[model samples]
Target: MLPSAIVSMTEFPLNSNGKIDRKALPAPEFTMERCDKVAYVAPQSPAHITTCEILASLLGVDKVGLDDNFFVLGGHSILAMKAIMAIKQAIGIDINIVNLFEAQSVRELCVLVDAELLRKQLEETEEFEEEGVF
Candidate 1:
């Protein structure tokens, strides 16, 4: 059966042994008032599109919006790393993990990616000039 609701915990409850306390976990509230669907927002730019695609593929979702938050969509550190690696391999840009966490949305991530790409290009240009290649 499909899940009825999604619960978000700020932090996992811990037992005296420092392990996750399953018994202390809050019960899931089965409420019909919750909406499971997210309104889709189309990506605006190439960077936005690429980020959205990467996030959707990593998260196993059919579609992802530019404004959709990664963590809110069930993304974790491992998934984040996978997503970043995929983005790097696909677009040749390395997005910092801290920046990804700070900017959780695809739109925000695209901006960061663009800046990083530009910075890399500028650095390469400087190095080439120093070598008298340009």
Candidate 2:
């Protein structure tokens, strides 16, 4: 995939009752391919939600805000390390204790989860290619 620049519109270029002025509006910052939202990129995966819910359950808490810090929700050093190990093993992420503190809510962690999944998939693909498996 080639990288391309998609310039942001300076203004909405609207008139009257808040409608877009198509003539003044800039062309899409991205091409149709770039604009197309891939199904894999969406955050509707069971793995992510189940993992977060498992953490919340282990913490014995509710309202598990995606940004809620694990420690603040009754997590201790041991528990944090343990959970990190579990997550790494189960989800292929090297989550650190610091990340938990920095990203308290589950929402913030979703980005990390996506990245880890992508990286793991890449690594597997590379391995397969090297082994001439496909």
lDDT of 2 by residue, 63-92 (tens): 344545555455676766776777777776
Q: Between which residue pairs do clashes occur in model 1?
A: none
lDDT of 1 by residue, 1-134 (tens): 23445679999999999999999998887542232355678987787788888898887777788777787776788988998999899889888888888885767888898898899899999999999999
State the C-alpha lDDT per candidate.
0.81, 0.63
| Candidate 1 weakest ten by summed lDDT | 30-39
Clashing residue pairs in candidate 2, if any? 66-105, 66-106, 66-107, 67-104, 67-105, 67-106, 68-104, 68-105, 69-104
After superposing candidate 2, which stretches have Cα over 4 Å from the reference?
Answer: 1-43
Worst 10 residues of 2 by lDDT: 34-43
Clashes of 2: 9
Model 1 lDDT vs. the true structure? 0.81
